[model samples]
Target chain A: MPSTTATTRRALLRTGAAGALAATVPASPRAQGPARGEPLRVGVMTDLSGPFAGAGSQPLFWGAEVAIELFNERGGVDGRPVQAVTADSQSKADVAINEAERLLGQEGLEVVTGIYSSAHAVPLSGRFEQARKIMWITSAISTAVLKDRNLRYVFRPTVHSDQYGEASVSFIHEHAQSKLGTPPERVRLAAIYEDGPYGTGVAAAIEANAKARNMPLVLKEGYSASAPDLSTLVTKLRRERPDVILHTGYNPDITLFLRQAKAGGLRFKALIGHGAGYAQIDRLTEAFGNDVNYVYNVDPVGTQMLDWSKLGPGVGDLAKVFVERYQAKHRVRDLPAHASMGFNNTWIFLEHVLKPAVRKTGGMSAEALREAALAVDIPVGGTIQGYGVKFAAPGTPMSGQNERAFPVVMQFENARGRVVWPTAIASAPPVLPLPPSSPYAARS
Target chain B: MDPFLLEALVNGVLLGGVFALPVLGLNLVFGVVDVIWLCYAELVMVGMYAVWFLYTQAGWPLPLAFAACLPFVAALGVLLHVLVVRPLLRAPPINQVLATGGVLFVLQGVATLVFSTDFRSLGVEMPPMEVGEVFVSGTKLAAFLAALAGAAALWAFLKFTYVGTAIRAIARDREVMPLMGVDPRRIYLITSAVGGTLAGFAACLLVVQLDVHPFVGLSFGPITFMICVMGGLGNMLGGFLAAFLMGLIVSVGGFWWNTEMSYVVAFVFFIAVMFLRPQGLFAR
Candidate 1:
């Protein structure tokens, strides 16, 4: 192997004859038959170098990359090649703003997606609205982005924070109380959260739900995202003797809570997490191991078990092509939520909207593409995740736009970490009573 | 206002003392060596993970795990000095800063690549012991007491021991220490090792309260540095004072305002203090 090389390309100038510079650059055609749908340019901006990079932003980027690759091969968007340029926001709002401007104003990107932190997404929403560019966010579920400043161009593909809380409450009430036979009143709940926007939002929602349901939230604690210790806080939680512990923290905080809870013999009737950091398969296994039994997380669930063939031809054929190519290239099993979400969305947009629009207009201009996307009808007949995607009317986007296919309340059975939720796409019914020493065991 | 609030505040102060332990070590290095040891946070992160592995993974008792880890921290410190610090000693301050900064990133990258980005907390709840009206957890009180005891031990080590005296003398004047037959390079290595060991010692107490992540090092790194500088560079006691002050700011501020706004308040306080005292609150 070659040794590590530390080469600093701080300053490299383009100098020489104008002819040489022009030679190096690819020649551009001045005019093309009134434009026949060129490569569809999409820009992705998200945190890549800050605190939240490893958590989801990087993984989300991989998801989008997979979608673009699949789209390009099977006859690009409406037979026009799709081009994607991704930029890292560095988790800075100002930087995100600047990059969004460049992507919109300079690159003439028709669609923009991917902002991991809500702090960045809130501002980016305004920019996208101004440019009338469509923005599809997979992560960053700040409800504020959806409300108060709702924009026509902005749409979130993944679950929102409010939906997360509501889904969590419903799942507990449905699964924990009825299925697990957990008594409603005896449900002593505690939330260990990081003192940040994400944690606070979930904690507040949980608190409200717990209160309205007449369940006592015995403990409500917040710690720094990078807090080094949780023994004391966990100890206080133990005293409360909560039957259910709802932790709303990032991956590191969750790991600490899991390890320390086991070490201290602080057993709970059910252990549930808000899927922020605990959703990943490897993270859960590594931090808890056998101890992860009965731990349930409310996160994005993919339709892994659903047979794509049942959804009919176009979508099913696309899925087969994607699965074969992806498996061969990456040598991995079926794509996770981060991969499948984008794949399904891209497939929907290309076949249902982009293709017909390009056929009608004879070109893939911004106006033609927008009209096509706006006229999307049969949202869910696709083989991918059974989502049935469609946009809601303006001023009420949440009511209509949220593809019923993806609601974030999937149960991960210990045998195989498959998403079993929304019943329509679930491979199996929610495990009636979480099995012992398995992930859902404690929650049982 | 309530008992929980009081407990959180007291715990914050005690935890703040533990926070000071490593920051104090950084100050010790800064006071004597005049270079910010950016890798000091990584030392703490590694030390906490060391304790986690020894006690949780290796099935050793907590004390044994801590004791076994101290020498490793010291060895790491010595290695850091020989490889990075010593070579950049005669260079410009910026070079020294950049070199140590590089070490910090190298350690963080190694941690991310090897350990994987996951959260780990000591899962067990510490037993709560009542002291008057306030309820304190066993692990937290232990951390608080350990912080106090460690601080006292550090003070004694710097004040009474011959090697400690030599270190202090070198801090005052590196050139003057040559008369006492001590190599400046050797003294620096010893001081850094001492600082690293102190960080390790602090970590054992830290994990007792929270779990350690590779990135937790970066979290505490800048905050502790801020505490050290705000308290007055090279003043160990001032670092302790500043930590508590910042701790109280976060705790009490969080109590009154929303938790999110508390950080903003702390930064405001820091800026105000900086404006008032140009150099710092207690700069030597």
Candidate 2:
């Protein structure tokens, strides 16, 4: 009787252990309906709140929604539907890392995309690399994430600061120098930037590019991002009297500096900026009225400026679709750069890698999805800063540069930003010697 | 290097005076009441918004806007003191801090929700008056002059007035002050009002020199706290001296080193002062 009882107890223990194992294991398949598998999960992290809320996040979500719908209509990635889980990073790096961890670890998301700011992407690069998950940076421009860190899982689909800065200098050389009837030497340049990585990095690149092209950078000024006043700096700029001024600043700072410069009778022959801030066409119109006529800056990828009707395959009619959907839902005008970025970045993920991987695996695993994304060879051929997309080797100058496209220089004319450089993608002629009514000319 | 350093120091001193002027009432109230005015920064924010609303929305002149904001902010201050600070005074320091902090958040939320966080620069622009290597704009000069005058006026009011003496006494001991024939509550209300008015004066200078943002209040609050503590918590004269020193440090340090580290050094100074001389450099 004791031997029999011991044997039964051992059998019961094995049974209980087997049951627990089954409970912990994910349920495999249902026989009847669609292919026996789970939906492919893609995580999108965006700047939902904070300073870059509207400009950096809205479009990404919209683009994802559009792609998700299109992919589902064609029968989901593989036979399983595509699911997206988006979280707000609030433009913070730490929050971004935490969200990426949750999506990868808890939700078991196969692929991730869409960090808005470089600040958010820089730190999260490590988390994604450790998990061996794909991180498609849609809007962030900081190069340090891929360049300094050698993050294998990271790939950037958007233009980096260097490209933008270089483009601006090129635009100045091509448009301003000849138009002003001045040699490169006569065209002295001054650059004033905000004291963050974005501003500092861009300013350094602009200076380098200008020097490479034999353009003298007469004045270099770094001002605090949250400085209460720029009057002292503006006064100094006036005294230096550079022929051209390139400012890497946010909207408020840009407007404030111009107002102060005008008051101080400071003048520059021309002014240009990288596309990070001061790209709001409408806000500039409202603030300065016709003063925005010839003040040129590299423009953000706003769909309104793109030729949506002529877009190539996989690019879709983004400009029209964005405007229509955005207007219908938010009752707002054209989608802003932030909104445009948000939407396009999400679409790139769904079309480029998500759908293809789901088809291959009959289901999505984080590892499989990352492999599929690496194999993707599509060009980001949209009107919003057209570029070829691919990843750089984890440790290379081309690592972040691999999948990123260079931003085209665009000019702001009549309070509207239109692509004007890289003659192939050029949409319009450059605007030289900003309008007389502009604060630039008035200060001069 | 020395010439630019000297120039930068002068500039910092001038700017520091402007930064300190608005913070005086806040420091005074904190020293006397033992209540950290979490809304102290918001006081300045509100003052700025009030000026903007009066000047732009209400179609008033610059001077009118400045004048109108003082009483308006003062009233708001008294109301805030009664609603938020008064009830929480006897609570734990953490609770007092939290209650005032709540007021700060509410004010920030309301401002952003209503006005939006766009930068509203004053329309009037003035030219800078350049002297050799030293460049000072008309607005900066005006801000410096106003800050000086305001500081002097407040000093006189505190030194010569009966109410000012009562306020200082109340700050030291609120319950015992009533036995000395001072109504602690009335003094609290009046002191709160004075704090708001000084914030208003700072706001006017801010609009003249810089653009106003709904979130600008947060940027300056901790710096003011540092100044107050570094100046000797209850000593107004100490606050002035610390403000000038802070100004010199920011301007010169910014020029000589990375401009971004100006505040970092100031914060380090704060920590050093807190540890080495908790009573502050000018403590009696």
Candidate 3:
């Protein structure tokens, strides 16, 4: 009986192996080409019901959905329809890891994207790498994820924290000299960042860049993200009297800082913010109104004030269509930068990587998809934000970082955010020393 | 003393005034009810959302919206007490804390669903009033004065009013209050309503200066709890003084060091006080 059971097991193994080969055989057209209308599944894991839900998750999800809609409207990826399977991570890293596993293993998705918090993204990046799946990070800008991890499957197409800090410093240097008549050395800079990964990374970058440029960093401070008050910090800032203040924090802290600063009579020649709360234009405007005006923020360009010519032909029209459809779908007048970048990067991924991979390999397998992403080299002006898509080589400092991605400096002018740096695409020049009529003008 | 330090100290005291209103109710609720009311800060949060909806969304006048918040939140407090707290009154103290914790999550979840977690602010524009070399914000000063006035009015009521005296008697000994012809349940209900009203009042004062989001309460919730603990649970005057003390320490420490260090110093002070005086600074 034992010998008969062994013989049956061997036969079963041989039969299963043969069946697997038969399924993959070139003779089966259904196996080679995606079934006529079968939708390509891409997972979008984000914090839909957590602390970050309003911050970026909702918009990030909408952004990716808009991209998929655009792709499907244009006869998706080699005529194989693309769809997004969304999972709410609830802004928790462990939940994100579980969602990634379920999406990749149970849902059988080849590519996953959309994580708002670095805490969620970093862990998912490792899981994706281990699983040999592709993860396109849209919003998490922490540098630590790509710093030492040489994960080939993980790719970030958006600007990172370091770039934001560099852009902020550069914007102040250029604008201070040109607008405020203060040179780099003569400028007094202070940095106040939330004591978190995102804030610390950006602050470190700002410090490094300031030192490189010989700028005097008078004060650098860190605070908790959910601090109830910032009056004391504002008092310290007032005493320091820095010419340029670079701040990085989330929504609540940012709102508190500005309010407390107003109360403390803190003003500067150039008040530059590095993304996060400052990039939330509508929220900032709603909270501060004219007070937010004249403040400069360095971040990814939102759907507004885009130079169409900078992006490749036909991409500009697509962006407009995206904005219109997004507004109609979400019923929001303004499309945030998180949503815009999410839409653009996902569209780029679909166009330059997924579709091509499916067409070339005759199937959407994980290895084939990663190879396509690695070979992706969209020239500058190819995407909606005029950013080129090219993942850096593995094992390098820029490991998964997008080399062509750079932060754009935008100044809030007349209750609108206008690009004010990099010369070529600036909508308006930076406003320096804030006019006396401005609410933020120095009292003295 | 340096003018900068003086201004910081003044601002700290003003902040303490704002801080006292919210924590006073928590202290009151805990003192009398013998329940933690963990969702106390969330009640303040709900009041803030009500003000935002009324003033910003519905175009109601700021004063009218603020006034409306009191009744709305007071009703909510009564509902919470009847539905959630009353049943747990017979349960263990831990059960009451756990029940209120559940209420906290539910309130936050409901708030997130309704408000969409976006930061909403009234954007009340008021110019700064220059006091010599120090600039005081009009909104902060108004909030401070309102909070102080609210506290004083409540104190007066507790001192003079018949209902207020009964409530205080209940706080002193719930068992004895029943023997004194005062119904404990009725007094508890009234105390809950009063606590909710105070939270609403604090919310109105806060909304003028801060943005309102779903988790806005969480930002100050822990600190307010700490203030309650430091002041001695159930000791109103002690909590009041503790609030101001914590505010001044945070302000001065933050000025001398950084904001993070300031909080560190506060926690250190809290631990030292807890070790030396386990019942808290003002525990009777």
Candidate 4:
């Protein structure tokens, strides 16, 4: 073998010195094992045993787990298998903070992700920022978490609550006159939301955007998502007779609203829902059947519901892999948006951020990962979800948010979502106002 | 009254009717057994699950599913009383309350394990009916009527039936009932069974109006307790009337304010009632 005086980038890579960050060890020519003694460690913090389980955290974990498994199969990130240390948030902020500190201080992991609740995300971002570690959040809709805080190490690739309001209001703005035969100014709007961070954040955006556009927001009401009776709220809506109802709520509350609205003869031209419970199409179909068909929801497009052919090459196959792995483990084929979010966001962090960190920076340190994440600029259809990955530069307004990331308004048809907004990737045209068959359609 | 206020008032009555059944059941249990089943809402949760499972998963007719839910929960009530309350009948009140509270978690956990946290609705709803200027939900109206019928039947049972007489007599004086050829244990068991039956009835009504999940009990549990306490724990008619008062407060208050503020108003009213009439509005 020949000896070299200096170590070049190519030489360092050829010698498998890519694990130069920490825990470095001698490597074989084939690079069979991790260059470091241990694999790349990441923390998956989510609610596993509390109210946020099942729908929120469990799916988030499952999707991330599938991604970890697939990444390991793909010879791992930078030839080192990714290892995930999961801590159940238990859906409590105090517990989440404690677990996060343990993960950062005790476990000494450089990165932690997968927080389902916005409340946890908001508090934990401060923790991660102070620690100078990366918190690649997969899902947390509230804009307050990162709107203008300008934290250095936090990045969220998923849609935010503000965007939900933007998407919904803009969709109506685009269609108000074209389809409703009524101008945006003439449309009587109402806002009803669950009194949680998620619902409240989205509702605030709706009010702001509506006011900006000079829309007549006749009613804005907040209610408990777990309220046993929404009849009083239903009666209020009936009397107001708003042309458009912008609603944001969680699982049971959405069901309650729809059922009561149907029974209270609450008529409306349209009811636009912002994610959360609205994302669960199959469950809504189970409860309302065809009644859920025309109702629209604002959220990131489901990976399976996207036009995969238009996306980057191999995106379709990757989505297929995720679904297959998800079904094999969960024994159910119904994939909620949260699961896809867990998988896609984790996968994005791995491919767009982590790989580049190792390949370009020659290390996977927190600083290197942040640099790599900031450099990511996947345009529309670059990811499986049909949205791109491009984080807003650090220290800017909405810093670390994926400026390219946007939610679409989807109409549920036969328990399947069809993108109906943002004409470029939309699968179908927006259905303005509910059809006559809809129980909630305005009284003619 | 304004149309919206009239609708709110009508909705309050419907809401009251739904709250009535569980209140009566808890009252019956407390009156005869003199032991509060803190897990009363949990029992109703289990009954809701039973009806949902029998109707949706078991593919039974809706009526048959409801029919099965009553006895199944009644039997569960018997089991609960025998396994937990019976042993602690002579124990400290706090201990009994703690034990039942523990069972509340057990039921929620088991339900989560089996049914997951997904909301399972009955998928049953009827169109609203026009009443002059107001619109009323058919499902709520139906549930309200059923709750009233259930309460009337409970009243008739307490007044007429031999077992029912023994139950009321035990409520009046436990020591005398045992001395006068009545087995207190049997009457207590029967009271628990009746409580369970009422829970089952409430379950059927709730499943139609709300979604069934492990934590469904949390939605109505606090309000049920508040109403029972406001009505004088063991007083059935008092609890029945208190349910309507609370319901009206919730409904009309919501009309005056927001749903959340209305709840605050209702809770404040409950606290005021507690301070003013600790023995309850209809207490003897």
Candidate 5:
């Protein structure tokens, strides 16, 4: 009787263990379906309540949401609905890492994207790599994320920091020589940047590119990002008297610099900015009024500036639809440049890579998605932003860099920013020497 | 002197004048209360936002907005003293510091929640005044003059008024003042209000020049505190002199090297002064 009771007890324990194992196992994609098919989960980690909440992350989130909505409306990724699971990083690096881990480990998402500050992006990208998940960095432009670190699963779809440097120098050299009658050799350049990865990377790139092109880079200086006063810097710039000043800074610094420069009467032949603070047209205009006029900003092509007709067929329609829907949803007249880039990158991944990956592997896995992404080969004039999507392979010069990604030089004329470089898509000619009203304009 | 260096020096003096306005109040409070108000800068930030709302958003005259900010901020200061500081009077210095730090965080968080971290500027455009080859910003010059006038008024009040004398007496000996029939609590409340009033005036001067944001106080706060410490805690005149000295060091240093080096030079000077004269440049 005792032997029989022990055997029954062992049998009951075995049965309970089997049941637990079955319960712990995730349901197959088919079983988890809502009538049609199970949705593909994509995690979006963004700064919703921190420093960059308004300027960087909020717009990015809205942009991605709009893109996902448009994609689902058009039958998302081979009839399977695309679901976005979002978590706020609170503009802190540790918090960003936690959110990324939660989305990937707990929520079981295979793909993740979105980070505003480079400070947050660097660590979060590493976490994504460790998890072996595909991280499509949409907005953060720090070069350290890809170049300084050995990241395999990480990919950036937007223009990088160094690209801004190269573009600013190249545009000034070409445009100034052509429009302002300044000799290429006579174009003395000064670079003032906020002391951070974003500013330093751009400054270094500007120096290298200018050296390569044999252009004279006269002075380069770095200042604290949150310095209360930049009057001394402006005074120094005035004394040095460079023909063109290339600056890299964020909102407050840029506002302070421009205002102080104006107050000090520090004028240059042309003033150029690398995205960041310059892209916020509304804020810039509000702060400085006509002072922001004619300042050339090198940034990714904004949706408003993109002439879709010049791009391939249907690209124009896509651009129109995006702008219309974004306007309708956000109740804003213009879609932010970061938002457009986010939308475009996400759309490209879903269309060119995600759907194809699902068809090839018959399921959504990190490896399959990455393989599909690597196989993508979209040519120029194919994307809604008038640029193509073709990411360079890992362990290369342009490693994980979008080879076709380039910035357009937009000149702020009458408080309106219009594309003015690379002539083909430019709405207006480059205003070399700026307007007479500009602080950097050539004095009589 | 080279014209550029001369200009930098002049600019530094003007900037120093602006810096003194905020530091004076902080110095006064620290001198009397024997407790550091870590949230002093955030008080100025609140004043700035108030000015922006009243002057820019509500379409009130700039002078009226400035007037409104003073009382509003002074009230806020009294409220903070009553709620946060009063209970911690008997606590250790570290406890008081930690509590004030909590107040700082709370104020910053509230500002962020209400204002949404977006930068707002008054953009009070006043044409600049040119002196020789140097261009003096009209806003900066006005702010400087206002700071000087405000400093003179404060000096007069502290020197001549009975209440001011009582407050000064309390700073000398908080425990002994109450024995002499002066209510320390009432005097402390008045001191906080006066400090907040000074912050409001400083805010008006700053809002014209700098962008108003939740964290704008941080930009000027640490440096103002340094000035207070170097000025001999409660020594208003010493704080005033230190403000200009530090400002000159920053401007001249920045001119000679860079902004970072300028800060380094200022800090080094501060450290040296602290080592040599613990009571500060002016103890009396």
Candidate 6:
């Protein structure tokens, strides 16, 4: 149930075609910086026609499109407008590898960006590193993409999965005292996740962070994301009665777990979720409505939720424009966080890396972009998502990762997520224990 | 008994009940037509999309949506048999399997093209009821009962009605039935439609319990076929019993160890059952 009424997807697609048309309309020849020959070509690769299309890839490209469009409006990179050539990743790993070859090799695009799955990013980054082309990763957050891989060509300004675990556990540690009436170390915790790279990675973090702090780790298990039954898992949880549960799963499994847990009478004081499925709040809201309220999810802060005043002077206004363009065209009431990830990360490349590379070298090249990426230094609260750009330098662990990037804990209040953790960026206090109104709320 | 163990057993019975209808539908087709509609689960998937589309998109009431789902999927079953299965009836069994498999792909591809992979639900839920020390999921309980009702109705149809007798007779001896004044072609078509109605029925039950997506059939489809083969391929009663047995093993094993391990244990049991009784556990 995206607010894009079925009719609107058709309407919006036509609008999208027109928008794509408008991007290439050639800025007024007499504008400042003067028009020049041959626009800067960047390949926008994403999952446009498969499983990852709707919730993950489509908005990612839209967000990137917004950033590129705005940059072109402001007279482009020294009057060479960006002309994006898009490719479909199609939710297939093999297709992703092939598309990378096609986009970077046959198509001969130097700077390629926009990835939705870490599965795609992992292989794509490796190929780009070998081929020596600039890949400004807009939004795919697997630690494996950049972890210990000293590739200078690939760069991500988005939060990765490893940071996901730290954010949720850190929130619980800080708030367990006042809200749960329990010491952080004494809290009963359980971790459940889909037995996939993303889920396993996050679950590991949750376990490590909890154990390091001596939190009572009651149970940790992984189930296939497509399991037809979670009743047994629910029964086990009911038996243990964990005070809080850390779960990482895609939307269907999350929906299945919630439905079954309610039916099995499983109760927990609080439930924390990592991004992937949780990024689409509308889906969760459509499934549970008010029952989802007060549930905490960890992801990079949504653009609309951040206190934009602290995001430097012009960044706030740029965010307003991003939201305005994004919401009106996509017809989403509550902006999906992926769109912001698309916009901010792409903005970083356009404003920081691409422009600087072309300016410094008088034209774009992989080595110049790599140098510009390494030299990037934006302090915290610098970008639209309130995280800055600073790629983890080569030879260090997590090369090409924006070390300043971090996820925050947000709770659903009437199905709209409000930041509630990492106190400084938080707009509201963490509603720690589940309120009695929730069907799964523990009976005190 | 440990309450947890009791709950696990109850959950198994409930799980089996939902599993039974799909098994019953696929078994019905395998038994009567002698051709396994390998795309059987995809029919259920289509029916699920129909129910979801009617209820959520078309603004129909839940019951009306479900009512529409049966006939809709039944017709799809008829269409499938007419377009795909009918021509392959005279072909090799492998060719038939391949054709049906193609239908599975076509159905999945079309669903993906139309719906994408976003999981849709009926947004329906039922509370858990306490029976003494154990908790029973009311939604599952109701689905289980509905499944039993579906199984019973199918049994009654095959056992009592004139067409049912012809179907059973045809299933028993396909070559001999044609000489006995019963048109095998008509019966196959009728059975195909009936099998479809059963899929539609199962889809109704599953839509409430599980989310509907294009690849959802992958989750339960293999397991259903396993139950069918383990229950003697086309034996309705054997499939019925085997479904519960598989469900119990999955549930209790999961209770003992973990979800993935439980499935491993179920597959192992299926294999063991095959080795011990090659024709199937209850084939005789």
* Best by the DockQ measure: 6
Candidate 1 per-residue lDDT, tens place, B51-71, comes to 887877789987788898888
True contacts kept of each: 0.13, 0.13, 0.68, 0.69, 0.47, 0.56
Candidate 1, A1-444: lDDT as tens digits: 001101110001111112322232224432221122476666766655445655555455555555665555555654475556666664457767876887788777777767777767778878777887777666766666766554677766556666666666656665666765766655677877886667767788788887777777888877776654454565466557776677777665666666545544465666667755665544455445555644566665554545766775676666666656555644544344544555555555556656777689876555666666667766554536566656555667453245444455555544235554554555656654445554223442
- Range of the 10 consecutive residues with the lowest summed lDDT in candidate 1 chain A: A1-10
TM-score of chain B of each: 0.93, 0.94, 0.98, 0.98, 0.97, 0.98
Q: Residue-wise lDDT of candidate 6 within B165-269, one digit each (tens)?
A: 999999899999899899998999999899999999999999998888787787789999999999999999999999999899999999999887899999998
The CA lDDT of each predicted structure is 0.65, 0.68, 0.82, 0.84, 0.80, 0.84
lDDT of 5 by residue, B9-86 (tens): 988998899789988998898889888888888899999999999987899999999999999999998998899899
TM-score of chain A of each: 0.79, 0.82, 0.88, 0.87, 0.87, 0.91
Better of 4 and 6 by DockQ: 6
* Weakest 10 consecutive residues of candidate 3 chain A by summed lDDT: A1-10
Candidate 1 vs candidate 6: which has greater DockQ? Answer: 6
Ten-residue stretch with the least lDDT total in model 3 chain B:
B125-134
User: A115-229, model 2: which lDDT tens digit per residue?
Assistant: 7667677777777778777787777776566666666667776677887678888877776556777776567888888866677778888899898988888778787655654
Regions of model 5 farther than 4 Å from truth:
A1-41, A49-57, A72-111, A329-333, A350-365, B273-284
The TM-score-based order of candidates, best leading, equals 3, 6, 4, 5, 2, 1
Model 6, A1-444: lDDT tens digits are 222222233334435544774754555654454435468877888776554664557677788888887777777787788777776666667877877788888788888888887778888888898899988787777787788788888998888888988888888998889999899988998999987667888888889899888898888988877688999999898888899999988666788898998898889999998876777777678767887888888988889998778788799999999999888777777777888888898889888988999998988788888899999999987889988778888899888999899898988877688999889868878876888888888997
Docking class of 1: incorrect
- TM per candidate: 0.75, 0.82, 0.91, 0.90, 0.89, 0.90
- Name the docking class for model 2: incorrect
Instruction: Give candidate 3's TM-score.
Output: 0.91
Candidate 6 local lDDT, residue A160: 84
